[model samples]
Target: MTRFNALLLALLAVAVPLSLLAGRVWIDPFDPQLPNAAVIFIELRLPRAVLALVLGAGLGTAGAAMQGYLRNPLADPGLFGIAPGAALGAVLSFWTGWAASGWALPLFALIGAGGAMALLGLIAGRGGGVLLFTLAGMMIASLAGALMSLAISLSPTPFAMSEIVTWLMGALADRGWAEVWIAAPLTALGLAVLGLAGRSLDALSLGDLAARSLGVDPRRLQALMIAGIGLTVGASVAVAGIIGFVGLMVPHFVRPHTDGRPSALIVPSALAGALLLLVADCLCRVLPLQGELRLGIALSLLGAPFFLALLLRLKRELA
Candidate 1:
């Protein structure tokens, strides 16, 4: 695990510089003639890359933890509905023309996440099993998605509707230090929460009854999962607008290299996710098109095929 983590760290070190240099107007770092190169690196590309690492790490960690808690390979952080809840909040901000305020959008989104978390707790209730918790999450996700759609349809102006739609597609474009500040601390705290739950998740792999016999507290573990995933996914959505697939896809990439323990998988998944998102964002910037590709779209394009392949593999195994 140490070697694998070290390898990932080494790869991330290489990828970060490439991400900084790759864009429509590529920077020749060695050349002294380039104008405003420092500004571009510091102001434009740096924050975007940092935000990718932060959000990707959060998503990846959350994914590993979720899959472990559910004991299902297909589980994702977004399955908990936190991301959709945050998106609904952001959409509401746009709907009401409050997004123009610097902090209103993220603040609204966080409140929405809190509401979803509260609802999830209420619906799941104490002693609710994993199945019930999952169902409650699905319910919240459905309700949030419906609400977001309603907001878009009832938008006061076409411009507002357009803004909401575009934001939903997701991007790191035009993001700055403010986004980094908003997401980083929340993501870091989330990662810590998930780390503390690692042992419980490992016990959970032995089945709920077995986990209980082994001194695992189901309610405590559930709370940790909810809080960890809520902070990580909510913060990501608050900053990046609904970037998907990172949580769903990242764990699979790293699981093979680990000992198949959730605790073993989390850190490696985080590093790999950071590398993947950074490279993908760089690709979005460098692609020759009228406009840079949206980060969410690019990941979806990659993730859809990957998901299909995974399903086919599972079918063969089942067969």
Candidate 2:
């Protein structure tokens, strides 16, 4: 399984770069303008593709770690509430004119995300129980989402509303290398932490009691895992907004190939996630609309129905 995951990672590390270079003008059979082609490739397509790869890899790794720690295949990065928390932080920055000033929004968004995770951790660990910790994280997410909506409603500026809505939809359009540098290191760190914890997660699959008997401390590892996932998702969301379902969907794509093992699922999920987001971003470029579609909307428009069908199939299998 590990070998297979390593293979998938190697494949994607190559594919993402080639896909970043692919485009309409360069790939077209009869295109003639060579100098303009360089400008478009460097200024437009490359950045979008890089953003997609980073965002996808970050969310995918976070999702894999969350599912393993929670022992629920359906779990995602949103489980920790960082998405809405970051959105709200961004909204606050826009309303206060901070986002207009510079990169303050991303900075504030990270703070908001970290704060929300900290609150969840404190509440859940009040008595040192697993179920309560999971329950607390869910509650924090729901509450943060509601608060984000409330903040939007209460803001007086109409322009603020439009800006907030556009951001929440998620887009890689017009983003530059700065967004890449902002997100990539955090994603890399988060992935490294999860990779080191993979053996711990494998022990966790045997249930917490079984893990404790084997000398793995489930509680400590869970705390670390949740914090690591929070950082990855927070950093990604701070830059890209609430891109949904990648976390939910990527594990589903990787699990069948990995035979449902936590250790095997992490890296493959990252690779599959990078591939999925790059494809989605490319579709965003070629869509027949005047304005580009948000990656979140594109993903939801496509993934929602696929997920519904998947759910129905699962029910039938269970029966």
What's every prediction's RMSD, in angstroms? Answer: 0.8, 2.4
Worst 10 residues of 1 by lDDT: 120-129
lDDT of each: 0.92, 0.79
lDDT tens string, model 2, 1-319? 5776777777777766666556544443256556676667667777777878878887888888888888886677887777777777887887777888658988888888888878877787744456887788778878888887887897768888888888889878778888887788887887887787788788889888887787777667766776678777887888888888888888887888886778788788888888888888877776778777788899888878867877898789889
Q: How accurate is candidate 2 locally (lDDT)?
A: 0.79
lDDT of 1 by residue, 100-207 (tens): 999999999998888898888889889948999999999999999999989998999999999999999989999999999999999999999999999999999999
User: Positional deviation of 143 in candidate 2, in angstroms?
Assistant: 1.8
Backbone clash pairs for candidate 2 read: none
Question: Using alpha carbons, what is the TM-score of model 1?
Answer: 0.99
Model 2 lDDT, residue 61, Cα: 83
What TM-score would each prediction reach against the true structure? Answer: 0.99, 0.91
* Cα displacement (Å) at residue 145, model 1: 0.5
Model 2: residue 112 alpha-carbon error in angstroms: 1.1
